[model samples]
Structure formats: C-alpha cells, structure tokens
Target: IPDDLLEAARIDGASEFRIFGSIVLPALKPIIVTLAVFTLLGTWNDFMWPLIVLTDKDLYTLPVALAALSREHVQDDELMMAGSVVTIVPVLLVFLSLQRYYLQGLLAGSVKG
Candidate 1:
C-alpha cells in the first residue's frame, strides 16, 4: 500500500474504516484470489497425506478414492479415465471462475512509488 494515498485520504477526512474499505481491500483483491487459488490447488490435489491419515474407506479424498478405484479395476481403462475426469472438473471450474483475478495477479505491476 502507498503511504501517500492513505495520508491523502486522511487529509480529505476519510475515516480509517473508509480508507481500508475503499483502498486497501480493492488493492488486495488480486493477491487474495491468487493465494486462495494456490491453497485450493495444493489441498485439492493432495494425495499422500490424506491417504496416510484417514483410516476409513468412506472418508477418502478424490485422489485417494481414484487410486483405490484404479487398484480395484486395473483392467478398466475407460473407468479410470472417467474417474480422472471427474476428479479434474471441479478444480477446472474453480480456476475458470477466478481466472480474471488470478491473471491480474500474475500480470500486476512491480514498480515502486
């Protein structure tokens, strides 16, 4: 955030909350979205930790479930492909939903004032 902008807002009699809401939050949107996407992708595709931690077959995550499905149906290529597609679709939807903000974050300027 720019100190000069906040100082200017103060000079204009804008309250702290107003300054934060009007300025800080908008400036942070791209960063927040980027972080959210990264975290989501990390957790969504995670396999090993969930597989090791969960004992119940019913509590498995998509990747672990997919792995088990593969093991059970080793001869079924079509079923394995279908399982993979189902696992990927939700993440793709999330990325497309936030694509604008994520791209903005990637292309944001780094120039210092």
Candidate 2:
C-alpha cells in the first residue's frame, strides 16, 4: 500500500499529504469508492450483526431499523422503496464520483493484445 502510494508520492513530489491529495488518492479513488460503497451497503443491510450488537431498536442502524420498520409496516410499498433509496444513494454518489478511475484502471489493465 505504502509502496504504491509512496511511488506515486515520489513522482509527484507534492508534500506527504499533498502527494496523496494530488496523485495517489486520485489514482486510488475508484478502488476506495468501490470499497466504501461495498462496506456501506454491507453494513446497511447487515441484519444479524446489528441484531446481536444492538438491543435497543432506537439505536439500530439503517438496515436493522428498516427491517424492523418493514415488519411493522409490511404493507407499505412506498416506505420500502424509500428505504431502498436511502440505502442506495451513498453507493450511487460514490460510484458516480469515481467513475473515471474505473475507466482508466480498466483500460490500463486491458492494454495487451
């Protein structure tokens, strides 16, 4: 991690943080966003862990809260849709923000014929 980041840092010669701010982070943004989205979604929908960890309904994170909410409001399709939207928005924003990196990395990886 540091090796790749530091190589990028060295080439750019921005300060330590500046190196990351300009070069390393830009290059890694796609992967970071991808992971963040995955982590967010995974945590969001994680019912069992939340159930085990959080005894109080008020303290539930979104997924567990939504699951409990769904049970109480089983017939509410709009509410379900809203829950889905809430869970998905962060992932969409992150992916949209980092799309260019995905394209660049994809191209870089496929450069042999």
Candidate 3:
C-alpha cells in the first residue's frame, strides 16, 4: 500500500513479482495471516452448505458429523458436550496461535492515513 516503496522498486528495475515478493507481500503479512485464519475458521465451522451439497456419508465435515451424532444421541448430554468441545478446540487453537497477527491487522486497519 506504500506507493513510494513500489515506485522505488520499479526504479531499481525489480520485476513485478520481485516487487510483490519482497515488498508488498511482507507489508501485507499480518493482514494476510489474519484473513487466512478467518477463512479457515469460516470453512472449518461451516455446516449447512456442506450438509446440503454432500450426500455421501464419508464426505461429511466435522460439523455435519457432529450434527448427525447429535440427532442420533439426543438424550446424551455428555456425548454432545464432547462433540461440541472437539468441534471448537481446533478453531480456538488456530485463533490463539495467530492472535498476534489478528490483533495487528485490527490495529493496522484502525489507523487513519
């Protein structure tokens, strides 16, 4: 997003790919990581679309599997809780691992030019 850095790279005869790899990509790292984490979380937790699209039992995602489990075990509170925990833990770990970048992206977006 910094025009001066890009202009300088152009003046130095860097290729577009080089400029992107050396300058733009590094500058965008935090935001990119943050976006990746969000995208992963969204995809991981998505249930309805996958349920609607996937008819095969083996292709069911974790959420869909959990939903099926819940339907079959409606009276079992402990099993449902365990399933819920299993579904949530991975997303929690991923968010915690990339929390720094997520916070950085939030701060970066909040700053006014």
Indicate which candidate wins on TM-score: 1
State TM-scores per candidate: 0.76, 0.60, 0.67
Expressed as tens digits, the lDDT of each residue in 31-55 for candidate 2 is 8767877787686677888789898
Q: What is candidate 1's lDDT per residue for 24-76, written digit by digit as tens?
A: 77778888887998999999989999999999999999999999998999999
- The lDDT per prediction is 0.86, 0.73, 0.83
Task: Select the stronger candidate by lDDT from 2 and 3.
Answer: 3
Q: Find the candidate with the highest lDDT and give its number.
A: 1
Instruction: Give the higher-TM-score candidate: 1 or 3.
Output: 1
lDDT-sorted candidate list, best first: 1, 3, 2
Candidate 1 Cα misplacement greater than 4 A, ranges: 103-113
Taking the tens digit of each residue's C-alpha lDDT, what string does model 3 give over 2-105?
Answer: 57767878999999999989877766889788789879989998989999999998999999998898898889999889988998999999878877875654
